[model samples]
Target chain A: MKSLLSVQSHVAHGYVGGRAATFPLQYLGWDVDNINTVNFSNHTGYGHFQGSAIPEPELIKLFQGLNQIGCSYDVVVLGYIPSAELIDVVASEVAALKKSNPSTRYVCDTVMGDQGHLYVNNSCVDAYRKLLSTKIADVITPNQFELELLYGKPIDSEKLLRDAIAYMHDTYGVDHVVISSLDASVLNLQELQLICCAVSSRFKERSQEQSQLQVFLVPEIKSYFTGVGDLFTALLADKLFTNNGNLVLAVNQVLTIMSNVLKLTHQLGIKEFTQHYGEDSCERLAEGRMNDGESMRFFELRIIQAREFYDYSGAGEFSAIEISN
Target chain B: MHRNLLSILSHVCHGYVGNRACVFPLQCCGWDVDTVHTTNYLNHPGHGTFQGEKNDGRTISTIIEGLKKLFDLREYYNVVLVGYCPSAEVMTAVYEELEPIYKTKDRKEGPVFVVDPVLGDNGRLYVPEEVVQVHIDFLKRGLVDLTTPNQFEMELLTDTKFLSWNDVKSACYKFYDTYKVPDFVILSVLIDEQMYSVGFSASTETVFYVPIQEIRCRFSGCGDIFTALLTNEFYSNGRVLSPQVLTLVVDKLHRILLTSFREERARLGRDPDVIHDINLVRLRDLFERSFGGDLEVKYL
Candidate 1:
């Protein structure tokens, strides 16, 4: 069965490994495994809260138990985590998990620092660095800042981007890397952002000049809601697994999915503010629940990114462009 | 608590929009999709009463300010606000100042704002790019109680392009996962994405195949009217159910828009590039009759 293991936690109910990460994967038909490392009453962003964290060994035990089940996982998604201890344990567990089920694809949502700042300690960040520097994960998604922090330098020019990708693959054993919320060329970069993505895996033919990078440009979407990374990574994993581990198809699909959501939020004029709106009642709340009653076809997806999925080898092999824009 | 109904509407007579929504909602709960000539686009800027250019899209801030001024909104408790067309922004703005007055603060029902995504008709974005983000930001903040985004809008929100049930479910649930806004709705189900083979008008016996990209039927502004009526039926009627009932309402709106499309073709004479009915709708059929209650299952 497909499962998602969210490592992060916060006191906020709306964000984090809570409803934000767990429910979507569950609704996506996966037998979601929610392994929250830190469980506060709410997200940490809303200030201090009283809660404890799950130690690395304790957390590893659960995944190890799953390994004992002998059923290979189709996909494994990792989100925010607590201490460096958890990260170290996670890296080892992930490595072992991959060794056992080599076919199992792991997607790491490297949520080091959020929209504003990093929520964890230096030890935790270092753990992510080490975890990422190994072959434990097949895919890594980090926002611009997270990429910078991981690389120990700002990701400004294209050289840095290419170098970063090479570094990730060579040093960390990362197969695929996606850096999000980039203002790469735009002057008002913060408002209008993009995602610089690269894919390199044993599953595909590799090329020296493939660059393995493409920019996922999206209109400006604003907000302070935590766990958007959880949502993005969850959808990405769902798409990746559903598409059967074709990284290009999966990443391309993720871009379209979130872009569509952003477009809808814009078209409908959904404002960025926290308050109960519309005809809110306990009755109305039920309509949003995840059930067959709530299921429906989402939208007409136009595959605009098919041409930009960069997977190639230097075998001098003639290849028809995957798609034409 | 004088329960007043607030509706934000615009875009009255485009080939994609219509004028019957007021009647439909008026028939059910006496609320309307408020109207004006402009999409608030294409007008010279700087006029407070009505300042945007025609195609530029009226600022949500402008529309919200207009709503506050028009309603003199400070006097009410437990207001049911249903917004459509260019009014999604208006619904969001009101939420900031409106929620505290009611919402158990005074043991009253505060302003309940429902936003109907009005980005496209027949599946296309009619507004500017910035507007899409503004709307998403609003929904992300939990300002929208009930959101009626079409199938296309759902893809836009979740960033999925070619989606089946799994992708669609992932996209829909992402709203809850990220923003924690519990009220997200996908309006209709097209029997086929190609729209080429599926879209039909049986009454007129018109079997015009929709182009692959342009498969959706041309309905002017039914979205604005649908969201308005559904929100009113939800908040104004004081219904106490779970989020389950919204799918029923969303399904009904889809069919209502279909029926509205046929009606528009009849009214506007199938103008190929455009249709007649946008704002006008038949609300009772959706909420009161509940679209035969079990009808939405056929598509699922």
Candidate 2:
């Protein structure tokens, strides 16, 4: 059995993101342990309320305790680090883990940016770049503005988004980069809006050639709940762990599950703002995309773009692995 | 002093089961629920065979007493009380009982009243005309701090058609002049007229006419979310908000709806799972987040 570890802001039964990310990992039958960075009373849906944050040292200690228990996760999904210190702690953890388990990879949900601006603390962007980008975070998921912040330029189109995604994948030495919530067509916002995109740079490492970039657009999902990014990373990590690390197939499987769940939400007439983040919502998703290890409908996603690579090495091989439970 | 907002509803859980059962997202922000009192008659606390069976005043009063005891006017300052659905009658009663206590004792901050007047939608009163009558009386007697009604509900209250932004403004002004409710929020409106103004009562006479930006699809509980957020914006800003500021809250809600639609499509028409995290009351923060969008606020 493969295990995955995810970190984000969890408010027990309160908010959607932490749990949204957490449950899907579990639903897919992966043993997932989540480390909450902050536990707000709930997802700041209520106007004013209170909660607490978990310190980085304590989080490190928690992982250490898990190690003592012989519980090593096959994948680690990191999201919304509340502080620069936590990012530092996570970077160190990723490095150490990768050393021991070369196959295990880190997926970073770069949640520091929102709408069209940066929302994370000013001190943390460099931490994300240096600590997360260089040494760890095999996969980095940043929305459009986040990509611009990382590249220090405006990403006006999908082409620009792809460029930024490729830049982070190569410069940071990460093979998988996903940019979400971007519009390819500015003139028509609706037609252009996409949920999320996965830009692949596997061949870039083998050749001096530019890495192959692929974009997987997540259907445009409202930022209603908190931990969706966390959930996406966890599912990808699990699929990769179970599948010899075939990032493409893994991305497809996870997307299928998310898309199916989103469709169910609409059928029920639930409001657009609050997408049921409760445990019950997971029950609706109670069933996972199954294919008897052959084929899954949700696994069939539209691949919007693919790039070619010739000479790329440190970037590693482009392989889609799927390890089934 | 700590303050809180309570969202009360009176409706057949089954009638709007989809709306009420999953309403927790609208009720609790910060995952905190002051109280949820469900009655049958969307606006009346204890009447009807509500939920289709009612006329039980004692059972309803007991619930009211329970709510009253849970929140003490003496302890909280600036507590805002909001009532929607068939529960408005009881909400009106709740306010009547609590208002004097809040005023005479001056112990806690005065409770702010925001009445959504859920009597109409899409320019027509959906509830029984009598139920709408109760709300009209509630507003006429001057019982709320702010009132928000869609074009239809506003017209039902004041009997006017919003032919243009100017017309909407005149009707709103007439309601205010006639009824004395200062802050009247027209929930969602679209116009082809000149997009002349931008945001807030930048100044009262300069009333801004923010040409509404249209985001498609209407899911349930929009009115509930709107009132909750608007009340927060109005009250938190010392009850004096720039019309443009409301755009931020409205925009977030619009996005949430769109996102939910995306999730729904992914799930084959299923509701988005994020609905679980929604508390009707905290919708304000959801819409007010730094990244949130704003309503195109404007006035005549």
Off by over 4 Å in 2: A157-159, A186-198, A203-209, A216-219, A223-226, A242-244, A269-325, B1-300
* Alpha-carbon runs more than 4 Å astray in model 1: A1-4, A10-12, A69-71, A114-116, A186-211, A263-325, B1-300
lDDT of each: 0.48, 0.52
Q: How displaced is residue B247 in candidate 2, in Å?
A: 57
| lDDT (10s digit) by residue, model 1, range B80-159 | 44344444344345444444433443222345555565565445776556557767775665444556667677667667
- Compose the digit string of candidate 1's lDDT tens values, residues A1-325: 3544444552212235533544445434454444456544335443333345655555666556555544356677777777778888888988888888777778887767854477778777778888877767777888867877778887666677667766776666666676646554522234334333344343223434343455544544444334556666777777766666666666666656555544543333222111224434334334442111111101111111111221211221111122111
A35 Cα displacement, candidate 2 (Å): 1.9
Question: What digit string (tens of lDDT, one per residue) describes model 2 on residues A194-305?
Answer: 5445446453346365655554555576444334555556556666656565666666666665555445443332332124345354433334322211111112111100
Best by TM-score: 1
Q: Note each model's CA RMSD in angstroms.
A: 22.0, 21.9
lDDT score of residue A131 within candidate 1: 84
lDDT measured at residue B279 in model 1 versus the true structure, 0 to 100: 26
Tens-place lDDT per residue, model 2, B147-245, is 767767777777887667677677766787667665666766555643222222323634454544454445565556556556666665776656645
Query: Every prediction's TM-score for the first chain?
Result: 0.72, 0.73
